[model samples]
Structure formats: structure tokens, C-alpha cells
Target: MTAEAETTTGSGTTTTSGRRPGTGGVTARRWAPGTQVLWRYRDNAGGRVHICRPVTVVQDTDELLAVWMAPGTECVKPVLLDGSPVHAEPLATRYTAPRTTARARWTGAGVLKLARPGEPWSVWLFWEPGWLFRSWYVNLEEPRTRWACGVDSEDHFLDISVYPDRSWLWRDEDEFEQAQRSGLMGPEQARRVREAGRAAAEVIRSWGSPFADGWEHWRPDPGWAVPALPADWDRAPARTAP
Candidate 1:
């Protein structure tokens, strides 16, 4: 995703202007529903971006930044052949799972992710077009680190799912346990993660922010095209000098 230039202000707001080399200026536009932007996450503060997804803005208000990931959008993700945690493998092969891009599609229309400022996880609402309102998925990941083009974070490998009744379940307990056993997460870290999950559950119980914000009524613009994965999805360094 080459750009003419990017500038970040002291307040942590970033702006990218001009056309991306190959994508033309498809990404240069005002922030509004149907605008396409890359949502990415780095491995560390200055590490290479290992995950990237292009999504359309569903809502971009001060209280919430909601985006939609349409079905079959190309995305970069880490996976182990045996389905082991990426950090569980021996050091020699830990990050050698063969960098690959795959189609990321949900079971239905797509996923609508909602995030608030300084939150540790974003609430993702899933559904089928006509039926509506399936479930809410809280993806527990690092608080987003913003970049000129989009936001970034590392997935914590654990998540919570809240049904319409407000009851919740830990979606990837086995993986979280495995990550802990594999030394990827220490005891204290695990405890904090659990606390974060609890915090999210409380929000669900309260029907907070996006939940009460009426985003479920949101629909993408029919004229908006499916965004293509930037050519640099896997290789770009999110921050050149932090």
C-alpha cells in the first residue's frame, strides 16, 4: 500500500493522502460509510505487519468506528499445520508457517466490528441479511495501534461470544490454555486477559455503546465494491520510526 506520504500528529491521529501506487486512488476519500480502509496489526511496536484486512466503513463517528469485512475478502492470517499456537512451535520454526493469504468470509453477509477509544477488544456483530442479529463476538486483542492507513493489533488468541440473551462463553479456552502452556502467555498475562473478558461481559450485560447505538440497522452501500487486499499486506512495516 504505497502512498504519497503519511503524517501522524501528537494526538495519535494519522492521515494518508494521494494514491496508493497500484490501487490508484481508490483508497483516498473522505471518511464515510462505504469508504475502504486497511485494518492491520503488527507483531510488535515496530515489527512487520502480519495481519491485514481491507474493510468498508459502516460508521465512523466519534463514539465508534464501525467497519464491515465482506465475505471472501483476501486477508493475511497465521496458522499452524497441526492447529497449534503460532508461538508454541520451536523457535526455529515458530514464524515459519509459510506466510500466506487466504479468503476470509463469514458464514453470512459479513462481520461488523465496532470499537471504542482505548478499548482492548472490539465487538463484532454477525448476521444474515434478511434474518438479522445472530450473535456478538468480542475479539480480545491488543488495543489498536493506529497507523496512517488503518489500525493494528495482535490477536490474543482468545475471544468471547455473547448471545442475544446476554449470556456469554469463552470461545477459545483451549487455545488460550495452550498458549499459556506454550509460554506465549505468562500467569499474570493470562489473569489480565481473563479480566478483560469479564469486563467485556459486563459491557454486554449493560448493552453498551455500539450495542445501544443502533448499528444493527446499518447496511453497506450497494455501489461500494469489495476492497482488494493491498499488495503489501504481509510485508509492510507499520511504523518506520517510533
Candidate 2:
């Protein structure tokens, strides 16, 4: 999770050039649907991976990258060093407290993550146990940097929850503020993240492509197997041309 130099696109997705998967040659290519890849997030204080989920590619193209995290998939997530849930810790010490990674099954409903290349945030769709449409979560963060293994980004600690009625509410403002106070994010970075959140709100208001698209009815392919968490889940990702 080294901080590699990145170029930003007009839409704000991060781009870099490096090695291609399967081929020793350097090139950018879409991951075929059903391909298993790791979607990871680097720790806020350090560039080490703190969150990693193995997902199956639903669709991949120049416009969007869609991945499905099936229920019960094993994943890595941060927890208090004492083995408590991070959220259970008080906000005052949440960001500053020491933490470690833990492996756990992705309980509850699966998630469908949709990201337009260069967008500063990704939209995650959720459902209830019976496939009942729940809501869309706007995760404000750095645009994903594509690599041979998968994609990586740093979470901004801010988010938006969009309901089925098209209504939305800001989420994690306290965490965002606390993250800055804890020095995990600088003032300038926080400003950019706020700007990014606003941009996402604008899209939600306008009822953009993803929201307008009928993804709520979409279902995972019955033949697609749940992707397994790889042994090297935290392996360094090789940059790939966008």
C-alpha cells in the first residue's frame, strides 16, 4: 500500500500505468466478468491495508466496474487491538486508538459496488435478506487505483446514505471531523473530501446514471461461485494503465 504517484482524471478517478494481469507486458484490460479480485482500502495513518474484500466481477468496461461481494465471503477488516469492533470504541479514541486486522465472514446481505472510473466515490447497493432493495451508500474516498490484483483507495471517513425514495442524508460527519482532529487527514484533504461529497449529492439529486439505471433488479449469476479470500490478501498491487 505504498503511496504511489497518481494522475487524476476529469471525473476524479486515479490512474496509473504498470503491469497487466496474466501477461508480463504492460497494458490495461477489463477484468472478465466472474473474475475474482480484491477490493482494498489502506489504513488512514499508514499505507498498510486495513480492509480487504474478495469480490466477483459482475461487469467491467471503460464506463464502470461492478463487483459483487456475496454474503458469507471471508474478508479482512480493522478491529481494536484488544479484538473489539472498531465502531464499539468511542469516537474520541476511534481514529487515534491502536487497531489490528481480523478475518470475518461478510454477514447479512451481499453488496453490489458500482464505480465510474475517475469518480472520487463508489456507490454500493444493499438489500435485505429476502432481496428487498434497501439503500445505496455513497462512500466518499479517493478514486480507485486499478492494478493487476484489484483496486485500492483510502476512505475519506465521510459517506452518504441514499434511500429508495431518492432521499439522502449525510453520514459519518463526526468521524470525518474526528479523523481530521486525529491528524489522519489534513485540512486541505478534508476540504477536498467535502467537495467530493457535495459533488456526489449533486449527482444523487440529478438522479444520475447509476441511480437511474435499473440495478436494483439485478441479481448475481447463479453459476458464479463466491470468490475466496486469497492467502496474499494484502499483497502489493501492481499499477495498471487506466
Q: Tell me model 2's lDDT, rounded to 2 decimals.
A: 0.87
**All models, RMSD in angstroms:** 8.7, 7.5
* Candidate closest to the true structure, highest lDDT: 2
Please give the clash total of every predicted structure, in order. 2, 2
> What are the lDDT figures for the candidates, one per model?
0.68, 0.87
lDDT: worst 10-residue window of model 2: 1-10
Best by TM-score: 2
Kindly report which residue stretches of model 1 are placed more than 4 angstroms away from their true locations once superposed: 1-30, 42-48, 81-107, 129-131, 235-242
Candidate 1 C-alpha lDDT tens digits along 1-242: 23356554453344456554333554432245666777876652235676688888776533467888887777776556654546566655454444433444434568888886567899888886684788888998887655445677777768988777767788878777766765667899888888888888788779876567766777777787888987766654444211
- Evaluate model 1: give its TM-score: 0.72
lDDT of 2 at 112: 99
User: Alpha-carbon error at 138 in model 2, in Å?
Assistant: 0.2
